[model samples]
Target: MRIVQEFTKGFWKELPPFKLVLGLCPTLGVTTTCYAGIGMGLATTFVLVCSNILVSSLRSVIPSKVRIAAYVVIIASFVVMVEMATQAWVFPLYKGLGVFIP
Candidate 1:
């Protein structure tokens, strides 16, 4: 129950893009099509998850001064890999999402 509650909390309370408006540009742009919206949301979620795991693992190694740069590099690399993979294998989805790939 607690686990479900914790997960459910995000449904209305802690939506990263909607509540905080963190990724409004992509949210707004991608939402024009339902497929694009889902694609963008999943992509963002993947990046967030990967970055969170990397940062948590490297928290001790990353200095407070340079953590931001390290995080950006990690996130950018994941985004590039996702973009390339999608372009190569899911060409139709990639074409549909064109400029928004990255």
Candidate 2:
């Protein structure tokens, strides 16, 4: 089905970071620890998904000139929230990660 194809295409063909190699530094560095790698990957995925949704919703309203700034602000806010949540609830993992996070 076309719908299934649309969804499945991303799995092997259009991965934002893996396929495009967009965030190689974090990908390579975080992957040393399996837990840390998974956590960071999920965090990146969350930010990407949230930013996509927000930008899609505001696409018509936002001026093209400032879209990059808008997207950065949205992504940064989510990252901060994630960082705080990790520090508060998973202090051990947070400590293990060290400066990679903050």
Candidate 3:
């Protein structure tokens, strides 16, 4: 019952982090310019959606004891990919982001 409840809760509830002040960087640095905000939002959305898909698909394969570590690694890899891509092509946004990407 609890497992079913947990699985169904996401359909109705928002992610916990969004309700928190976890995106101080985007709210501050990226807000300076519309383009910067768009770039940051796109990068964040891509990483988040991709990572969620990957993690949900691999949840059964990942070990219970180290699932959090596995998730972090997965998210980190996506973040690195986004960062590298941003730096390579969107140099302006990359420079604007500064310390926020990592």
**Please, what is the whole-model Cα lDDT of each candidate in the order they appear?**
0.80, 0.78, 0.85
lDDT of 1 by residue, 1-102 (tens): 998998889776787666566555766676767877787788778888987998899999999999899988998998898788878877876777778766
- List the candidates' TM-scores in order: 0.71, 0.70, 0.75
For residues 1-102, could you state the per-residue lDDT of candidate 3 as single tens digits? Answer: 998888667644566765455554564566678888888888888988999999999999999999999999999999999999999999998998878788
- Estimate candidate 3's alpha-carbon lDDT, on a 0 to 1 scale: 0.85
RMSD (Å) of each candidate, 1 decimal: 8.1, 7.8, 7.1
Model 2 C-alpha lDDT per residue in residues 1-102, reported as the tens digit of each score: 998998889776787767566565765676768888777777678877887898899989989999899888887888787788889988876776667776
**Better model by TM-score, 2 or 3?**
3
**TM-score-best of 1 and 2:** 1
Q: Note the residue pairs that clash in candidate 2.
A: none
Candidate 1: misplaced stretches above 4 Å? 1-19
- CA displacement after TM-score superposition, residue 79 of candidate 1 (Å): 0.7
